[model samples]
Target chain A: SAVISQKPSRDICQRGTSLTIQCQVDSQVTMMFWYRQQPGQSLTLIATANQGSEATYESGFVIDKFPISRPNLTFSTLTVSNMSPEDSSIYLCSVVFGTGGYEQYFGPGTRLTVT
Target chain B: AQSVAQPEDQVNVAEGNPLTVKCTYSVSGNPYLFWYVQYPNRGLQFLLKYITGDNLVKGSYGFEAEFNKSQTSFHLKKPSALVSDSALYFCAHSNDYKLSFGAGTTVTVRA
Candidate 1:
């Protein structure tokens, strides 16, 4: 089990503005991931934050739109660039700890509302 | 591609009665299935996982899951439901360090 936290628990941003969500883990983790959850919907993986490298994005998501940075094992950030109303969703950060890597623990999530 | 499905969008049961949330998954190799619960305004909490070697696995809060490889199902069960147990549940499968999650099922236990 891991303790994960996200900054700016809830935010309201104007359209065309960019927002960066921070994820911090209590213990060092092997894998960190970013996800998006639409209103009353399931989660969609946005990217996997690789330490000291670019994030691996899933289909329908691009780096230019959702850039990620993982400077170390315990911290990562996901920036949603040029946001729109459609980008208003709950952004979550999850991490896999230790050797097993089978289970993932998630942060409380950042609720971004683009107006 | 690995995928998971939670057929029911919502499940309603009476408090103190037994409850089950259905899940099924598809993967190329052996499956690493997991169940997580999400309370309102909170993060997803890991309930249990089935990597191998056990048909039935118990987890926190007296919850358990039975992994039936033949049916490709891993259903979460609780012997007695509590009103506090009402929450959104997710079924997920892992492959290559990435997880494929189901749409999620909202469980409502009434007292």
Candidate 2:
């Protein structure tokens, strides 16, 4: 299993501002997934970041709103642009191991509160 | 596509009592079922998984889940509940590379 570390465990941000969350994996991986958990909602896939390529965003998500960057195999960044109160949620990054996809490890998550 | 469902929003259990958290999944091919626990302000910790072989699988923290092919269910269970066991439980399914998580069930254990 890969150990994932996310920065800014919790943050209070002003509306219209922006915040970036960093996810670092202890080992190299080909794919890193980002998810959002809104209040009283299930975890929703935001995007899949593949190193050396643009992220593949899911439906209802756009590049401008939630930009993702995978600079290397072990690290990725997700930025919430033009924050609003609706943007408040826990952002988690996960990495799957091996071809079988038997296990997936998640980061503690970045708790963002937009006010 | 793969998806999971947790029918109960919350479950309350008395200390030392047996507990069960229900889960069901849908996938195109063979299903990989998993149970994860999440404490407040923490990431999801993998408890157990059911990929192949035996229906009954044991996981961390004395948790276990039984996979039923006919019913398409993987229910998590604990022989004895403790106050420390209170947390959010999520069921997931994987067929492709990504795993789909359920809405989550909050378990509150009363002493």
DockQ of each: 0.84, 0.68
- For B1-111, candidate 2 gives per-residue lDDT tens digits of 568899999999999999999998887678888998998878888899999989999999999999999999999999999999999999988656667789899999999
Task: State in Å the error of residue A110, model 1.
Answer: 0.1
Worst 10 residues of 1 chain A by lDDT: A96-105
* Candidate 2 chain A weakest ten by summed lDDT: A96-105
lDDT of 1 by residue, B1-111 (tens): 679999999999999999999999887788999999999999888899999897999999999999998999999999999999999999999887687889999999999
Model 2, residue pairs in steric clash: none
For the record, the alpha-carbon RMSD of candidate 2 to the native fold, in angstroms, is 1.5
Q: What is the TM-score of each candidate against the true structure?
A: 0.98, 0.94
Residue B30 lDDT, candidate 1, scale 0-100? 89
- Each candidate's fnat, in order? 0.76, 0.53
Sliding window of 10 residues with minimal summed lDDT for model 2 chain B: B92-101
Candidate 2: Cα lDDT at B105: 97
